[model samples]
Target chain A: MPLYLIGLGLTPDSISLKAINIIKNCSKVFLDAYTSILVSYEEMTKLMTEVLNRNDLIQADRTLVERDAGQILNPAKDSDVAFLVVGDALCATTHSDLYLRAVQEGIQVKVLHNASIINAVAGTGLEIYKFGRTISVPFFEEKWKPVSFITKTIENFQMGMHSLLLMDIKTKELDWKLYMRGIERYQNPRYMSCAVCCQQFVDVLNTDNDADLSVETKQDFEEIRIHAAKAGFSVDSKCVACMRVGTDDQKFIYCSIGEMAKLTEHMGAPLHSLVVLGNIVSDMEQEMLNLWKL
Target chain B: MPLYLIGLGLTPDSISLKAINIIKNCSKVFLDAYTSILVSYEEMTKLMTEVLNRNDLIQADRTLVERDAGQILNPAKDSDVAFLVVGDALCATTHSDLYLRAVQEGIQVKVLHNASIINAVAGTGLEIYKFGRTISVPFFEEKWKPVSFITKTIENFQMGMHSLLLMDIKTKELDWKLYMRGIERYQNPRYMSCAVCCQQFVDVLNTDNDADLSVETKQDFEEIRIHAAKAGFSVDSKCVACMRVGTDDQKFIYCSIGEMAKLTEHMGAPLHSLVVLGNIVSDMEQEMLNLWKL
Candidate 1:
C-alpha cells in the first residue's frame, strides 16, 4: 500500500487521466483544503467522486494536515491512500513535507504533477524565466506589518526580473479563531482581493521606507506598473488587468494603482495574484501590456 | 474557429481528459517538437492518437513552427485547431508568441495548462518560490561558446536564490546541419547530461573568466553543489542524485565538479535539468537533499 500525492490541476477538467486512474484505485481519498482553494471546490469534488465512483472523499483541513498527518499516513501503511491537492502537489511546502514523511515512514510514495499557479502565471504574457523569487502578502495586522515583500520586489526590480505576489487566503482554523475573537464574527473565508493588495502596496511604499530614497527609486515606486489577474479555472474565464499606481482617477477603473485600490468590481473569485513588472524585456510583453494600458 | 494551445504534461498519462476530448473534436492537430522533448514521444503520440481515434497528428518542427505557423493558424480560422506542446503550453516564449499571434488575428484561443519542467523541478526538493531566473546552457561551439549562464548562476547565489539550469537540446534542424557538416554525422537528438554540464561549468570557471574573483567567489564556483535528476514519466522511475563539483573521485560518480567532468556513465535519457543550490531555506530541503548526498 503506497501513498499517492496527486495534483488536481486548476480545473475539474485539468485533472490528468493518470491521476483519475490512481484515485479510482486508492482505498482512501483525502483532499487538502488549507493552502489554496480550488476554483470551484464543490464542483471539483463532485466531478472526482462521479469519475471515481467513490463517495469516501474526505476533506483535510490545516489541522489534520499540519498536526495530524499521521491520520493519513497510518492508513497508507495498510491501504492505498490518495491525498489530492489543488494545483500541483509540490507547489505548497507542506505537501512536500508529507511526501517526505511518507518516505521516512517507509510507506512508498508517488507524486503526480500538474499545473500550479507558479507556472500558470505565464498566462499573463510574462516570460517564466524572467521571474525572480516569489513572495506572499499576508493580511496585515495592527501590530504585525511585514514589508519584506516590498524589499524583495525592489531587489527583483534591480535584477530586471518580475516579482509575483500571491495574495493571502484564510484557510487555517486556528487563524480563523484569531480573527473571529478579535474582529467581526468569522464570516466566510476571506480572500485578499487585488483592490486590497493594491492598497497594501501603496501603504507600504508610502510608510515603510526610512532611508533616503534616490529620485529614480522614488519615481519607480510612484509609477510602478502592476499586472493583476484573477486566473480562474480556465483561459476562457481568466481576467488580466494592468495599471500604474500613483496617478489620478482612483476607482474601479483600470488606471492607476490609486484607482485600482478603490475598485469595487470583482475580478472574479478567490486566488488572485499580482505581478509588479520589472524591465519589460520582449516586444511581445510590451505589446501585451499595452492592450491593458489606461 | 478557435485555436487551442494544449499542454501535454510530463508523461503519456499526464494528458488531461479535457485535452483528449478536445482533440477528438479538433479538425487539425499539430505537435510542437523543437523546444522540449517529452519523456516518451512515440509512446505518447501513439496513446493520444489511439485514444482520440485520429491519425492526422502532424509534428511541427522548428522550421514549421517559426516559418509556417500560419499552417496551423490559417486552418484554425475555419475549423477547430489544436497546437499541442510539451510541458505547459506557454512555458516556452515561442508558444506565447504564437498565442499572441492568434489573439492579434482575432481568432478565438484557449490555453489548456499542464505540468511544466518549471514546476516539475520542484520534485528536486528545492522550494519553488526560492528559484530565481532560469538559464539555459547551449552546446558550446568553436565560435559561439556562451558562459552567461555561469554569471547568472553566481548572481542567483549572491541573492540567496536557487538557479534552475535547463540543459540544451539540439532539436532545431538548422543546428543539426551546422553540427553534421562539422563533426561526425549527427546522431539521434542530444540531451546535455549532468556530466557534460558539470564539465562545461568547470571549463567556464577555469578558462572563461577575466574579472577579479574574490576568495569566497572563487570557492563558490569551485565547490558549488548541484542537484541532478532524470525525472522519468513515473515517480518510481525518477532519479535524483547530488554531487559537489571540483572534489576528487569524479568518474561518472556523484561527486564534485572536477570529478563529474571526467565521468562516463550515462544519467539516463535526454531532457535533464540541473539545480545549483544557493541557500537551503528549509530543514525539509536539507533533509530531502541528504538522501541524495554523495
Candidate 2:
C-alpha cells in the first residue's frame, strides 16, 4: 500500500493518464481544496467520477489537511490512497510537509509531477533562465496592506533578473464578521488582479509608513525610492500582466506598471500573474514584449 | 484550425487528456527530436500511437524545425496540427520562435503546457521562490571548456538565491569527424552528469585560463576566485545533485561540490540537474536538505 501524491496541472483536462490510473486503483482519493483551485469542486467531482467510473473523491480543505492529516495518511497503511494537488505535487510547502509526514510513518510515497505556474511563466516569452526569486502580491485590505513583494521585485531588478509576481488567491475564506456573530459562512473567492497589485506597488512606494514592516528596522521612503530608482524600477517600469496562463483564452498585456495601475477597468479574471522586467532585457525579449504591448 | 503546441512533461504517461484530445484531432503530429528527450523515439512512438491509435507522428529534427518550419505551420492553416515538446512548450526559445512565426503567418496557435525541470526542481525541497537565474553546465570538450555558468552561479549566491544548473544534453548530435568527410552521421546521445559538472566547476575555479571566456576583456584567476569566495561558493559549497527527476527512480544527493565531484562512480541515468545552495537556506530547507544529504 502506497500514498500517491499527484499533481493535476492547471486545467480541467491537464490530469495525466498516469495520475488517472493511480486514482482509479486508490481506495481513497483526496483533492486538496485550500491552496488553489483548478475548477469548481462540483465540476472536478463530475469529471473525475465520470473518468474513473468511481465516486470516492474527497475534498480535503485546510482543516482536514492541516488539522487532521491522519485522515489522509491512515488509509494508505492498508490500501493505496491518492492525495491530489493542483499544479505540481511539491510546489506548495504544505504538500512537501505531507510528503515528509508520509515518509516518517514508513509509508511508501509516490509523487507524480505536473505543470505549475512556476514553469508556465515561461510562456511570457521572457527567458525562464533570467528570472530571479518569485514573489506574491496579496490583496490590500483597509487595515492590512503589505509591500514586501515590491521590495523583492526591486531586489531582483537590481540584480538584472526578472521578478515573477504570483497574484494572491483567496478561496473558501471565512466571513470574519459572520464568524464573530456566532454564525459561520464562507466568503466568495477573491483573486488579486494585476491592476490592484500595481496600484499597491505605487501606493507602497509613495508611502512613508512602516507599519507593515515585519523586519526589526525600517528605512525612510526617500532612501527606498532612491534604491528603487537605481534598480531601474518605478511605477513607470515595464511589466507583463498575465491572465489565466496555459488555457485557451489565456491573455497577456505588456505596459508600464503605472499604466497597468490605471487600466483597472480592463483587468479580468482570476489566477493572474505579473512579471516586472529587469534592467537587462535582451533584444529578442524586447521584440517578444512588443507583441503584447498595450 | 489551430496549431497546438503540446508539452508531454518528462514521463511517458505524463501526457494530459487535453493534449491527447488536441493531438488526436490534428492532421499531423511532430515530436521535437532536438531540444530534449523524454523517452526514446521507439518508446514514445509506441505510447503515442497506441494511445491515439494513429501513426502520423513526424520526428522534427533541428533541421526540419529550425530550417523548414513552414512545413509545421502551413498545415495548420487548413487543419489542426500538433508540435509536441518534451517539457513545457515555451521553456525553450526555439518553440517561442515557432509560435511567433505561426502568429506572423496568421495561423492560430494553442499551447498546452506541462511539467518541466524548471518547476520539477521544487522536488528538491528548496523553495522555488528562492531560486535565481538558471544556468546550464555544458559538456567540457578537451579544447572547448566554458565556465560562464560558474560565474552565474556565484552571482546567484551573492544574492542569497539558489542556482538551478540544467546539465548539458546532446541528442542526435552531429559527429563532426564524419560531417567533415561529407557524411551525415550523428553520434549517440550524451547527457552531462552532475559529477562531471561539479568537477568542471572545481576545474574552472582552480584555473586562471581566459581562453574559455567570450567576454570582451579577460579576468584574472585570482580576481574571479576572490569574487566567488566572497559570494559564499567554493569547491566545498553545499549543492544538490538530481538525477532523472519526475520519474519513479528519481534520486537526489545533497553534498559539498567537492564531494559530489569525487562521487562520480555512482552518477546515474540521463536528465540530470544540479542546484548550488545559497547563503539563505531556511531552517525548513536545511531540514529538507538533510533528508537527502550524503
Candidate 3:
C-alpha cells in the first residue's frame, strides 16, 4: 500500500502543485487534525470534494489518531492512501506514530516538504538562528504553576538569544463540524493578543524574578502592538496590526500595556496569539519597534 | 478593497469552499511562495486554472515579492484580491508584512486563519507546551561555521524540550534563475540529513566541551523513534518515519548511528532530518529497541 504524508504550509495557496495532484488522486485520506489546524474543516471538505471529487472526509481526532491509527492505515495497505497534518509530515510526532504503523505493515511511504511555522516565523527578521530554547505559556490555574514557559524564556534571555513562544490551541472541529461565526469565536477563548499577552507575561514575570524581569524596561515591552486577525480566509482584507513589521512602515511610537489593552475593544474580530517581540527587534522591523516603543 | 488571506493549511484539501470562492471571484490572485510553499506552482496552476477559470496565474516569486510587491497588492488596493500561504496568514511574518504594507496604503486587509506548523506539531502527542526555541539547520558549509544550530540544539536538550529544526532551502533555481535536477540539486545545496546533521552537530559541540553535547545516547534516540517529514499541503506524496526511528528496516538492522552510517550505502535514499522523540517515546516505543542491541 502507498501512503502519502503531507505538510500544509502557511497559506491556502502555499501548497506545491505536486501535493495537490497526490491528494486529488488518493483513494482514502486521513487527516491528523489535532496537531494543528491548517484551515477550517468546512473549507477543507469542500476543496477535497471539488478537486478529488470525493465526499468522504475521514476524521482523525486526537483519540482516533492515538488508538485506531492502524485502522486508518488499512486503505494504504492496498491502495494509494493519504494521511495529512499541518506544516510538514514529520513536523508532528503523531504523524511519526502513523508512519511507524505503516512501516510495520510494510507499506511504502513518501513525504512531501512544505513550509511550517518553524521557518515561517523567520519573516519577522528576529534572527531565528539566535533563538534560544523555545517554550509555551499555557493558561495558568490558581492551583498549578505553569512556570516552565517562564523558566525557558529566562534561559533564552540570559543567553542573549530570542525565544519563540508558542500559544495554545483549544479546539478542532471535524470535517462535519459546523462553521463557526465571529460571535461564536468571541464566545470561545479568543486568540491571545500582544497587549493582553504582555500584561499576563509581566504578571508572571513579576511573580518569578528569576526571569530577570527588571532587565527589560517594562515600559518598552509593555508597549504592546495589537495585530488583530480574522479566523477565515479574507481575500482583500490585509492583516491589521498595532504597527507594521518588516517594512519601512516602521513606527516606534510606544503604547502602554494598559493603553495597548484598548486593543481588546478596538480589535473587531477573532484574534490570534500575540508575538511579543522581545530583546531583538531589529531596525529593519520598523513597525514592531514603533508599536512597542516610547 | 477586501483582501482574502487564505491559509492552505498542510493538506491540499484543507482549503475551504469560501476560500475557493474568493480565489475564483477575485480579479487577481497571487500565491505568496516564500513564507510557505503550501502548494506547488504546477499543480495549483492547473487546478486553479481549471476551477477558477482565471485568465492566468500571477506567479509571484521572491523577487516580485521583494521588488514589486506593490503590483501584487494592486488588486487589493481597490478591488477584491487574494494572496494565499501554506498554513495560516499570521503563521509567517511575510504575510504580516504584506498586511502592514496594505494598511499603510489605506488598503483593507483580512486574514484567514488555518492550521499552522506552530500549533500543529503538537499532534504527535508530544506536549505542545513543552517545546523550546526553534532553530534552522543550514545546509552544510565548508568554511562558514554554523555551530549555532548545535548550541541551540544543546540548549533544548538541556530543557528536555524537542527542537523543531528546519533545514535551509538555498534553492538555486529560484536564486540563480535556473532549474536543473540531479547534480544540479547538489550544487543547489538542499535538504539536510540525519547523518550530516549529526556530524555538524558533533563538530559544533567539540568546539566547547563544557557546553556538553552528550545527552541521551544516539542509540537511545534512534531506538526510541525518529520522525522525518517535509511540510506539504498540496502534495500527498510525503513520508513520515513514525515508528522504529532508531531500529532497522527488515533485514538491515543496525544498533547505533555508527552502524547505520556503515549501512548508508544500502539504506535506500539519503534520509531527511529526524525528530528525536524526547517526551512521547515511552517504554512502549522500546519494542523497536531490538535494533539498539545489534
Give DockQ for candidates 1 onward, in order.
Answer: 0.38, 0.69, 0.12
Error of 2 at B283 (Å): 2.7
Question: What is the per-residue lDDT of model 2 for residues B1-294, given as tens digits with 9 covering 90 to 100?
Answer: 998888888887899988887777889988888754665567678888789778767889888987899999999999999988888877854376787888899998787888888888888888888888899888887556666788888887877889999988777789999999999999998888999899888776765565666443234345667788777678889999998888888999999998999987776777789999887888778877888887
DockQ versus reference, model 1? 0.38
User: Scored by Cα lDDT, where does model 2 land?
Assistant: 0.82
Count of clashes in candidate 2: 0
Error of 1 at B20 (Å): 1.7
The fraction of correct interface contacts reproduced by each prediction comes to: 0.65, 0.73, 0.12
lDDT per residue for candidate 3 within A1-294, as digits (tens), equals 578776555444444455677777788877666654554456567767766677776767878877877767777877887776655555435355666677788887666545454444444434444555445556543334344554555455545555555555445323333333323222343354444544455454343333444434333233221111111111111111222221113222234433444455543332233333344445545463343344
Highest lDDT: give the candidate number: 2
lDDT of 3 by residue, B1-294 (tens): 777766665544556445776676778877766744435666567668666766476777778877787887777767898887765555445454666677778886665545554544443334443456666677654435445554554455545565555545554444333334323332443545544544454343233342333443332223222211111111111111222121122122323333333333443432233333332334433443332233
- Model 1 error, position B63 (Å): 2.6
TM-score of only chain B in every candidate structure: 0.76, 0.90, 0.66
Q: Which stretches of candidate 2 lie over 4 Å from their true place?
A: A141-144, A172-186, A206-220, B172-185, B206-220
Question: What tens-digit string does per-residue lDDT give for candidate 1 at A25-108?
Answer: 888888877643563457666787677766677888878987899999999999889988878778765466787788899998
Show how many residue pairs clash in every candidate, following the order shown: 13, 0, 81
Can you write out model 2's per-residue Cα lDDT over A71-174, one digit (the tens) per residue? Answer: 99999999999988888887754366777787799888877888888888777789888898888888877556565787788988877888899988877789
